[model samples]
Target: MARLRDRLTSLSQPRYLAWRALPLGSFDPRFARLRIRTLVMEWHRTRETPDDKAWCEQTLEALGHEVTPGIWSGEVNGLLWARPRESEARR
Candidate 1:
């Protein structure tokens, strides 16, 4: 896991690899679950709270995603592409 750690560390900094190191995954079910689990754990450790559900919900909303009580997934391209309100868009 040294390689993964090294990669994570290297990409965690403000550099060209930052975006690439975001732990994003694709069609691979195992890797996708792993990335989500790791992100949740890290977020919890850093925040010192296990209330990520709220944060996730808010973020999804801000990103124009439609959140449902029974479905709170973090799938790829899960968030919606928000558009400004009618008045705001016209401004």
Candidate 2:
């Protein structure tokens, strides 16, 4: 698809493979929200700071997400709710 082609052209990398495999809806406008917005797979990479990874958990709490060892769930911006599980510890 054009989107995939565009993405590949912009930056080719292994990480992009996993990113591309995500559901189409995952790219919805919500994912592009301002800093401190909702995130999916990568907690560290989603933090507000451009190069910082420590804000993930703090931001998640602010958004009402509860994190356990391998699971997390809650509403983001009070508009969306999610419950995802991590297969590996500390992922």
Candidate 3:
């Protein structure tokens, strides 16, 4: 995920694919529904409304993720990555 963080920062527009191929019995059940890319997109799509923002943030937190809108960042467990901000892109 360190590489993911670096790629997100360096690329003008970086995209990611969530890891979902783990064996059903190989890991914790909590991670069964954690599709990282989907989570980020859902956040980006619904960040406009206050209710939606709260819900998404809460959901991410419940999944043991840390989300930072200011940095366009999201961390899954310990893995971390970020998207470039609109302001930064214009600069």
For TM-score, the strongest prediction is 3
Error of 3 at 16 (Å): 10
Question: Would you give me the overall lDDT of model 2?
Answer: 0.37
Instruction: Check candidate 1 and list the clashing pairs.
Output: none
Worst 10 residues of 1 by lDDT: 36-45
Given candidate 3, what's the lDDT at residue 42?
33
- Rank ordering of all candidates by TM-score, starting from the highest: 3, 1, 2
Task: List, residue by residue over 1-91, the lDDT tens digit for candidate 1.
Answer: 9999999888766422112233332122232122111122111212332444455455434433444443233422232222333333344
* Per-prediction TM-score to the true structure, in the order listed: 0.27, 0.26, 0.30
User: What do the candidate models score in CA lDDT, each in turn?
Assistant: 0.35, 0.37, 0.42
Tens-place lDDT digits, model 2, residues 2-90: 99999878776543323224453233234223233224544323233342222444444443454332244233311222233233212
- lDDT string for model 3 (3-80, tens) is 999877766432333223343213335443444432343332222333544444554555555555644433322222
Best-to-worst order by lDDT is 3, 2, 1
Residue 30 accuracy (lDDT) in model 2: 40
lDDT of 3: 0.42
